[model samples]
Target chain A: MDHKILQTARELIEEAGYPALTVDQVAVRAGVGKAAIYRRYASKAEMAFAATMHGQWPPPLTDAGSLYEDLLALARAFHVRMATPTARQVAPALISELAGNPDLDAQFQNTFLAAEHAALAEIIERAVGRGELAGPIDPTIAHLLLLGSLAAGLYIINLTVDDTMITELATAAAAGIAALADRHHSGNPQGATQPQ
Target chain B: MDHKILQTARELIEEAGYPALTVDQVAVRAGVGKAAIYRRYASKAEMAFAATMHGQWPPPLTDAGSLYEDLLALARAFHVRMATPTARQVAPALISELAGNPDLDAQFQNTFLAAEHAALAEIIERAVGRGELAGPIDPTIAHLLLLGSLAAGLYIINLTVDDTMITELATAAAAGIAALADRHHSGNPQGATQPQ
Candidate 1:
């Protein structure tokens, strides 16, 4: 029943939009009673939220063992998702809607953004503890800049719902992060590559 | 005349919505003849496009000498616009309506996405041509990752507005990019730097 509701909600959002969305319409479309819909979801907003996330295809996250590999994992997941057209379409509307509705904003945060940050930050924090990063480095800023470069990857490359987009973003992002860390650690640009 | 018309259109949009937008209301609010508006714009949709974009703040691009610095400039400008409470109020509705309407869609894409991407792509293209980046990098995916990462940053960081948001994003982005480059070219896990 929950799956039915989610599937129905996804169809509605893909066809129409958030403003035009209605719970009664969802119930009818799902072949369920209004009471059934209400019993599962408190409101159309709730249902919409679930439906929006229904078909998310997160890329394979590889454990490269090194901090760079870990970071690359995050970037790769982002690249694959951004490159996929289906994911690209409705996901943006969610962000645009973030400023208006606190619940939706919170949902996006709790479910997605915070987790990725935590994963990356934890890796960096561990590196700091191990004296891998410089003593003066800020974990907060590290997360910010790391994520920022990933953002830059989007504007520089056009994600046309294809594999080339994926490889290009992933490789470039990997290159960009490697360059940044090398600079941060060693004053010498040439010193960026030490024997692993 | 354009200013007055835009201000009035904004008021109407805020008070009502995209659904309620009409030239008749804009004329009455601006104390201008409807013919005056039609003289400049082909339709109400066009007028609405201008009104909504009246405050659109695209990135202030610059050749910061390096990919990292250039990326920072873009993020900082975007941050300024998004940091204001106005970003919260105006951008949400504007994006919503733009996504919903094809006419407004053209305006939004041209003014915001296309222009910004052009600025960012110039930097990436320069890097690729210079052989700093590997050949055949997809500019599209790169842009999406950049923008999507920023969108992701807003939720993850415990910040208030777009400036802090973009600033953080830019720095982390630089770091990530630098890190990736280091891994690919130098085999260094840390201490990568750019050749000045």
Candidate 2:
């Protein structure tokens, strides 16, 4: 039923990309009637959204005791998540498709991007709580550095996102955050506010 | 006439996306015959690639005296290059299309990615020559951090790639590279190798 349709949709996206995914094709592939899919999703976009939601989402962030460990753990988890065969195929398609479609983009943000942002924000917040990170850390920028570096390595440079790459990225991100915190503290002592 | 056809192709991509940019439509829009376009480009991909290459690429890297200034300059330049209306539309489409099309991917690498990598590598080389960076700085990683962070900020988070964002990214990247260099130097005194 629902699980079978979703799995079939994921496979379709992996094999032929997002554009090739059609409601009819998904129904045919899943051996279900079109009416069944239409009952669950109104359109191809909805089907893709539902399929992505049903697919692998990054796991909940765990407290790794230290900021370095937390970032490393997060990076490693994200690397593994993005390294999946489905993710490798689906993510680029989604990113491109979402860029043009605002409604889909909003749905993606609400469903996926926001959760990822929150996970990274939590890691930064915990570091601040432990007094390991200084006040006024921009979690968005930190997340961007961490995940963006990984994305570039994986997508742009065509590098294998292995343990070594993840470790290096996490370490560099930690150092970058510390440096920014120090600069902010020294430059704007009174403006520095603790992470909420 | 060639320029006009290329411009029309770019407009087609911007308006209707890459898939919609067909030789027939481009000929109609550019007020040129199909044979005229065919004389230059064998297919739509070739036309799109030519148009992109004919359009703005990021400027060559310039020495800005200090590593921080050099990186900041490079980041700002890249930000401007990516912030173009055409770039905003075409880049994501190209990325998605290129992932599946190995011939286009190879052309993209040979035409664009390799040049960018070399430019960043040259910048890092100059920094090492001046003793600004330690031995064994990985330019590929450095380029990934800088451009990847920029791409995430621009594309993913939907953040405006403004001056403040560029400055912050460049600063963080500079710090990250410096930290990595120090760690590399300390941990692998004998094993440290220059950027390949």
- Model 2 has a DockQ score of 0.38
- How would you encode candidate 2's per-residue C-alpha lDDT over B1-196 as one tens digit per residue? 9899998998888787665678999999899999999887766766876786434565766788866678888888777767665566556666666656677677667767777777778877787787877755777678777888887666655566678777677777777777677768766532221111
| lDDT value for model 2 | 0.71
Residue-by-residue lDDT tens digits, candidate 2, A85-140? 55555566665666677777777677667777787788888877878767557777
- The TM-scores that each candidate's chain B achieves against the reference are 0.61, 0.77
Chain A TM-scores of all predicted models:
0.57, 0.78
iRMS, all models: 7.1, 6.1
Worst 10 residues of 1 chain B by lDDT: B187-196
lDDT of 1 by residue, B1-196 (tens): 9889988987887777655678898999899999999886656656765666445546456566665556667666655554344434554445444445666566556666677667667877665565554432333444544554554344323246445445434544544444444444564534243211
Q: Candidate 1, after superposition: displacement of residue A171 in Å?
A: 3.4
Q: How does each model score on TM-score?
A: 0.64, 0.83
How high is the lDDT of residue B166 in model 1?
Answer: 52
Residue pair clashes in candidate 2? none
